[model samples]
Structure formats: C-alpha cells, structure tokens
Target: MDTKSLIIDTATKLFQQKGYIGVGLNEILKECNISKGSLYHHFPKGKEELLIACLQNLKQAITIDIEKIFEQYPTTQDAAIAMIEKIIKNLETEGTLTGYTFSSIVSEMALLSDAVRNACGELYQEIESIYFNKLTADGFSEESAYSIALMMTASIEGGIMLCLTQKTSEPLKTISKALPNLLNSNIHLVNA
Candidate 1:
C-alpha cells in the first residue's frame, strides 16, 4: 500500500488498540515504516488530521455495509440479527472486539480537539440514523421506530463492549438470538 494508506491503516489499528491519547506519532511511523516527512506530508495537521481521515473512512465503510444489509434483508429483524452476526464474525477474525471507530475515541472525546470529537459524534449519529431509517422503512411508526432503533443501537454497542471484555463473541451471539424476541416485545408494546 501507499504511504498515506499505510499510515491511516496502521494508525487505525493502533488507535483501536490504544485509544486516541495512547497512540503516538512515532509508533505510527514505526509501525507504518514511513519517515516523519512522509507522515507530515500526508497529514499536515498531524495525528488530529489523521484521526479525522480515519473516522471518515470508517463512516464510509459502515455506510456501505449498512446499505447492503438493508438491501439483502427484507425485514428489520433479519437485518438486526445479520448485523449482530457480522459484528461477531468481525470481532472473532480481527481479535479486537472494540468497536472499530468511535468506541475507541469516545473516552477521550472531551480532551480531544473539536474536529476529532465532531468526527466521532457524526459517525455515531450516522449509524444510529441507519437503524432508525431501517426500522421506519420496515413499517414501524416514527416514534416507535425511533425508540426501537435507539435500543437496537445501544444493544449492539454494548454487545461489542461485552465481547471485548469477555474475549468471546458469545455476548454478541446471545444478542443475535435475543433480537427477534426483543423486536417482538417492542412491537407488541408499540401496538398496544
């Protein structure tokens, strides 16, 4: 890969493993095997700029995945379970159960630059919006869909954390198994 791509990819892994404040320019350079000049040339504003680029890339990647889920699954329940299953598979394969994008940066958002915080915030809202939009498209009332979507998003995020801490995807798999029941419960409440 090119120097810029290499830097972003390496930095992304380091950031996911170490968080925003934990990672350093030297480590990124060393891991990426690129000179300071090249790093600076690609990221003029340094780590902050690089992080924002990483967030943007993550947003694009998630948007595509979510779009595919919506296309492939005819029902919200199916889509939700599929999403959870994908997360389990990815966490197992990557061996890092931490939520890839904002989950890594969230703890340091208050201390980080506004650009970094905004990038994280926007990415989060985008994902939640995807869930909300999908639920509504599946014929849920706007208010009910909004509430259910929030629950779904929270469940997935929490599942990621549980999987990370437990070092197993069982928490995520349990979530996948429970989603159908969760949806049914919520749908009944909404209808009642």
Candidate 2:
C-alpha cells in the first residue's frame, strides 16, 4: 500500500486498540515506520486530520461489508442476524471487537473535536441507513424502519461492548437470535 494508506491503516488499528486520546503520534509513526514529516504531508492538521481519515476509511470499509451482507441475504432479518454473527465470529477469533467498531473513539474524543464528532456521526448514520433501507425494502414503513434501524444499531454496538467486556460472544449470539423475533414483531405491528 501507499504511504498515506499505510499510515491510515496503522493509525486505525492503533486507535481501535487504544482510544484516540490513548494513542500518540509517535506510536502511529513507529507503527507505520513513517516520519512526522510524512504524516503531516498526508494530514496537514496532524492527529485530528488523520483520525478523521481513519474514520472515513472505516466508514467505507464497513459500508461495503453491510451492503454485501444485505445483498447476500434474502431479507433484512437474515441480514441483521448475519451482521451480528459476523461480529460474534470476529470477537471469537480476535478475542476482541476493537477492529469492528469505533465506539471507543466516540466516547473519548467526540466531545473534544467537532470534526471528529461529525466524522463518527456520519459513519454511524451510514450504517443505520443501510439497515433502514433494507427494512423499507422488506416492507416496513419509513418510520418503523428508522426506529428499527436505530434499535438494531444501538443493540449491536452495545452487544459488541458486552462481548468485549464479558469476554464471551453470548451477548452477540443472543442478539442474532433475537433479531428475527424483533423484526417479525415489528412486521406484525406494522400490519396491525
């Protein structure tokens, strides 16, 4: 990969492992084997700028993953369960969910930087929108789809945290099992 891509990738992993505030420029530079001069060349505003880039990269990568799951599954319920299962698998294999979500960054640096906050917010919205669109396509009203999307997004994020903290995929496994029932209940509510 190119220097800029390499820096972003290394920084992303570091940021995921250690929150935005927890990681230092020296750590990222050493990890990437790049100098401060090279980092600034790619990110003129330094850490914040690099962070925003990392968030954007994460957004793109995750968007593709979600979209692909939506394509492969026949229904939103299946897709949602699959998404949770994917996370569960990641946690099981990696022994952590750090690489899968950026909630740590949101908790640590969101309040400190508007640019960072906006980038994280946009990433979240993109993920929610994918779910929302799939629900609507599966016949949910816009309002219902929006609500379900929000719930699913929040639940999955919380599940990831639980899995990380509890060191078990049971929370996510429960989520995967619950999603179908949740989606079906919403369908009934909409029909009624």
Candidate 3:
C-alpha cells in the first residue's frame, strides 16, 4: 500500500483493536513506522482526521458488501439473514472482544467530533437504507419498510454489541435465525 493507505490501514487496525480513546498517536506512528511529518502530511488534523477517514473507509466497505448481499438475494428476509450470518461467521473467525469498529468509534467520539458523529449517523442511515430498499422492493409499503428497516438496524447493532460483550457469536446466530421470522411476520401483517 501507499503511504496514505498504509497509514489508514494501520490506524484502522489499531482503532479496531483498541477503541478511539484506547489508542495513542505514538502507537499509530510506531505501527506505521512513519515520521510525524509524514503522518501530518497525510492527515493534517491528526488523529481526529484519521478517525473520520477510517470511519468513512469502513462505511464504504460496509455499504458495498450490503448492497451486494441485497442484490444477490431475492427477498429482503433472505438478504437480511445472509448478511447477519456473514457477520456472525466473521465475528467467530476474528474472535475479537473489541466489537464493531463503528460502535467503538461512536462510543468514544460521538460527542467530541461533529465529523465523526455525522459520519456515524450517515453510516447507520446507509445501513438502514439497504434494508428499507430491499423491503420495499419485496412489496412492503414505504412506511412499513421504513419502520421495519429501523428495527432491523437496531436489532443487528444490538446483536453485535451483545456478541462482543459475551465474546460469543451465539447472540448473532440467534438474531440471524430470528430475522427471517420477524421480516416474514411483518410482511404478512403489512400485506394482510
């Protein structure tokens, strides 16, 4: 990777391994093996800027993955479950106690930086939108889809939080199994 990407990758790993408050600039510099001048050259606003960039990078990656899942699955329920299952599998593989990067960053920087807060908010909306669009495409009304999408987003995030705290993917697996039933129930109610 190039210098900027190298810096971003190192910072992202550190931030994910350690929360926003848990990591220090010196650690990032040492990990990246770059000088202060080089770091400042890529991220002038320093850690704050780097944090925002990392959030943006993660958000983009998530959006792409979610969009692909939605595109590949024929129904909202299938897509949602597949997405949740993928998360569970990933969490199982990584076995990290740190939880989701977005959650960690939001907990640490929500009140401190407007850019970070907005980026987080936008990321959430994008995630919710993925579900909203999928549900609507599956023939649910716009209002119903929007409401269900909100709940789905909340449930997935909550599952992630619980899984992280418990250090097990069982919570995610349970959530994943229930999502199909929940979406189907909502679809029936909306259509009925």
Candidate no. 1 TM-score: 0.90
Q: Which ten residues in a row have the lowest lDDT in candidate 2?
A: 91-100
Candidate that scores best on TM-score:
2
C-alpha lDDT of candidate 1 relative to the true structure: 0.81
- Displacement of the residue 25 alpha carbon in candidate 3, Å: 0.7
- Total backbone clashes of model 2? 0
Model 3, span 33-149: residue lDDT tens: 999999999999899999888888888888898899999999998888888888887888878633244687788889998889998999999999999998989999999899999
Per-residue lDDT of 30 in model 3: 94
TM per prediction: 0.90, 0.97, 0.95
Cα RMSD of predicted structure 3? 1.5
Clashes of each: 0, 0, 0
Q: Which ten residues in a row are the worst by lDDT in model 1?
A: 97-106
Candidate 2 C-alpha error for residue 95, in Å: 1.3
**Model 1 residue 51 lDDT?**
89
Give the clash total for candidate 1.
0
